[model samples]
Target: MLDFRHISAARRLVPVLLIALALAGTTAHAASGPGASSKGLRLAAMLGSQDAAKRAKGLSALRAWGQESLPGLLAAMEAPSAEVRRGAVMGAALQPAPALAMESLLNALGDPDATVRSLAAHTLARLGPLAATDVARLLASPTHDIRVAAALCLSRMGPDAVPALAAMMRRDDPPVQANAAWLLGGMGSDALPAAPALIHALDTDDTRLIHVIAEALDLIGPDAATVLREMTLISARGNRPFSRMGAAAAPTLVKLLSRPGTPMGQMALFTLARMGDQAKPALQDALATGTEGQRAAAALLLTGIDPNMAHTLPEDLRRTLGGAIHLN
Candidate 1:
């Protein structure tokens, strides 16, 4: 039984497999190489098979060839059958050499099948920094999926892409700086190398760029602790950065909580309690290994936010907090 109402909504969801490139001409070796053509034809048949086992068997053989699989994959990419083309896109990912993939998948960008195009982009992303510069160029693409894929691809490149982003940050342009910041944050802790650059970008006059940089710093969590530690709990300028920080700011807040009678301590408690679920892991870590003051502060904070979690505190910490308080 199918629900007719949900069918349109489901059909609109693009099966995002992701790939890219222009039809940069190179002779597809499998089309002419001895023995490769025969093997490639068999591979295309198995890869496009309706049976899962045959597909698995075909995929294993493709991976085993590593870079040697490139020619067959490229030849298969040109097949008249869209299913075989889609399978070729999947096969490209298994080898994932930029030298091979960039050429092998060039045809897939114009692939009429959306799934094949998406799968191609996804495979290209697996090429990491080798494909990052080209993909980063697409961040400003008018196409929504293209921009998303570019960002996703950059984020997955880890530390290797930081220097390129660090260079982008130096440009006088605001959008480029902001996008670089967003991508650095996307790299999380691997972004440590760019911290100095990020800190320097705070000199910009644009409020929007400033806000995005701050949010990006927040996304990098404690990696930006040098920045977070200095955030004034009262100022709008300072508080906004800290506010977007979620649990990453918990340790410093817990430190403020150590002096529970102070205004900073009260505000820290409120901020931690307001963070809800995001604060749990940090709070749990504090309870487990932090100083007595941190443990006590965490227990009191958790009691107001999550009584069940408060009750899970160690016997020593619970005794120190004089037992958890009732929310009511």
Candidate 2:
């Protein structure tokens, strides 16, 4: 009974109405949650987009989705492009609960690209103490770069890294020992517990290692005062094994005299000025009987701690220090 023209128009409009309804459904689904699998695929593709801006937007959206973004990011980690893999790692780090992506991040640590590996390590660090166990494993890797990256990540975890770093200090490998020392030093007073191990390592003949150990001791601040003073005295005596200890302690010693206007500062200055006298037996012995280099070293250190004593020095000792004593 309907007109042919009207029937033809209704048929033509049927497909257009169906398409609009489908788009509306999709829009509503996207608005509700990222639970739709298609939405996830689209986001993942966006993350791997060659355009940097699109990748950044995808990362932002994924972070907004929170835990919902984890699976897609995990999948993106295996993207053929190293760039996509790097982006995935970064996106994982930006999630509201980064620890949720820990497994994916741990796997990314062994990525072929160095930058990706480094980024993965840093991302784990951003997860804080929660990433400690996985990061600890990387420390044992035979690869130097991986070990170093792990050390850096542990350093960023603050006090939580103490146990792992303290253990590393005992390793026979010099680089391992050096990296551990550097991180411990970065911890400041928190690293006081590792002082004994660091002091023990100072027995090495490597000047580089010695320098790092001294720096670590210095960074431990007043907590290391007792050890510092002992090492300083030994170094002052011109002992070969502890030769570089004095130079290492110089900055910390000077800090003690920083508040020259305060009572504590006055005490520090007094103690430093008399350090030469306290070590007088060694100093005198060196000036009276040691070689030119030994006497020069002893006199120079003495003159540094106490300038007034310069007049009392023997002619030869004075000459060894290059004429009148001058403290830089």
Candidate 3:
């Protein structure tokens, strides 16, 4: 019954009118009560929309909601759509605190989608101690990637992760052991309790692991004295060549100046000199009774620790150190 030309014009105008209405509604929503709630609902609905652009917008909006939107975001993690699940996990990560979302994020670690699981692990790491309860479970995951993710997360948790990381040091898997050592080393003095396991791992024939263990020991700082003493005893007893042991045990080597100048002592002196003031006390003791080589080495170490101190050394020691420094 309508004219064909009029009908065609109306059809074209329909899309234009819809777009104008959408814009007007958005503006009105920005200025009214219940607007925020309506907008949140719209975004939440878009999370499951088939359109990728709509889903992206939804995720952005939810992230802006932060803690306020956590409940809905956590609920969305179980959505049938992988894209929606991904968006929800990301949105949950944006919360100011882990809050009630910790369990949801941990559960997401087992998401069927690898990307989602990885994002979940990264988010958990950001949550720090809020997610500590899952550390053991994540470390025990059958999947290698998940284990790696857990280790990486623990590495950033500082002292709080010491117990879990120390336990991981004894894992039969070489990669797990290596990662634990690396993380413990990065934790510095906080990882002191893990020293025994790290020291024992040094006996392994695995050359690569030996380096990691040594670094962890070094980071355990002065508390490593007992292990260092044992290492010195082993080296002196000819259990291992000095060359094989000197570099890893450098921090303790300075303390051994009271002993005779073996190859280990020579290497220790060299190592100490390179360590600056950390070696001062040991170097001073070396000057008191060390052989000419040891005294010279101590003087040279003093030069690096403090050139003024080196100049103040007894004339004879300075002369000897000067001659040896040039050669070194």
Candidate 4:
């Protein structure tokens, strides 16, 4: 079984996935002249070809045709060949008007092939803010598969999708509620405005919901810091305490660290480690003769705070504090 305690703390230190706009738009030949029809037809046909070279050639031709191929590409999304369908979607992705291109991608979202659906989701996400309305529609779709795809796409849309996400939070479904919390955190500061909803979610007894909301609050930073601090205090006395609370609240909980001889200060240092370099100076000062637990927490914080600073800390300090301590 996963150690729920340490997992929450590590989650804050973990890096957010790299947002790769793979289909955002890539280079393609600009089509022209009477041969454009021939090129487009050839590309459409290549979408189903067994030969990889021919398929590549087909993609090249359709991309060359640009916006002119939108209608044909839309029609080709239903092609028996999954490759053709995916190729058609990719071709549309390269067009200046992806809104039109995405119609086929949206339909392709229901493709029996999981690979095709994942590709469509990734492509729509790459379209960024333009995919917002489509993603919102996906969230409301009858199929959970579509909803998941939409949620994933919106998560990648960053801050732009927060308004729509905040609206979705009103729904009582736990999956929707949980995903909304995750996406809000994935967006960072743009999600600052979502503090109230997350704070309310944190009050729920559901560990899943509370942990996710706590993570989101960290992403929202100090704007949501005080609530997390209060919750930490509440949790400290509750049946289920939140050891990771201070680490998540590190950036905004600086004042807690400034006061000497406080438990909150130790928590702040742990949180600072999660925030890395941003929490450095405070962590350095807090390291002074605290306890084995405090020093160990500082060592963990230093590992990721800043690569340069990590080198500055003496090896003896790291070795002395190498063992882990229970956060509570």
* Candidate 3 off by > 4 Å: 1-68, 112-114, 158-160, 170-175, 186-193, 200-212, 218-226, 229-328
TM-score of each candidate structure, all chains considered together = 0.48, 0.53, 0.47, 0.53
1-328 per-residue lDDT for model 1 (tens digits): 0112322332233232211111111223232235765566666665556666666566666655556766776788888888888777766665656447675553464567666665665556567677666666665555545554445446556676777677677777787688788888777778877765765565555656765665565566543245444442222254374445555556555555555654445556777887777777777778877667767888877776777665576877766666445422
Error of 1 at 195 (Å): 2.3
lDDT of 4 by residue, 21-125 (tens): 122223555433355444444455664455656555555555566578777667767777776665566556656787777777877777876545655666676
Query: After superposing candidate 4, which stretches have Cα over 4 Å from the reference?
Result: 1-42, 45-52, 140-144, 201-207, 224-328
**Over all chains combined, what TM-score does candidate 1 have?**
0.48
lDDT of candidate 2 over 1-328, digit per residue (tens): 0012332343344334323322321111221334544444556565546665665556556645667767766777887778667656665666678788888788777778765666676678777767776687676677766665576568667788777677777777666687778878889999877776776566555556666766776777534355654555435544455453443433333333324344323433444445545555555565675456545555665677677667767876766665558534
Preferred candidate (lDDT higher): 2 or 4 = 2
Q: Which residue pairs in candidate 1 collide?
A: 17-118, 17-119, 18-118, 18-119, 18-120, 18-121, 18-122, 19-120, 19-121
Better of 3 and 4 by lDDT: 3
Error of 3 at 323 (Å): 27
What is residue 116's positional error in candidate 2, in angstroms? Answer: 2.5
lDDT (tens digit, per residue) of candidate 3 on 1-328: 0112332343344334323322322111111125544443455455545565665555556545656666666767877767667656655555677556888877776778765665666667666666754764476677765665565557546677777677776666665677678778877888887776765555554546655666566666634345655554433434454433343444345444423344334445555665566567767766786657557666777777776776567788766566554422
Itemize residue pairs with steric clashes in candidate 3.
none
Clashes of 4: 3
Instruction: Report RMSD for candidate 4.
Output: 14.2
Q: Write the candidate numbers in order of decreasing TM-score.
A: 2, 4, 1, 3
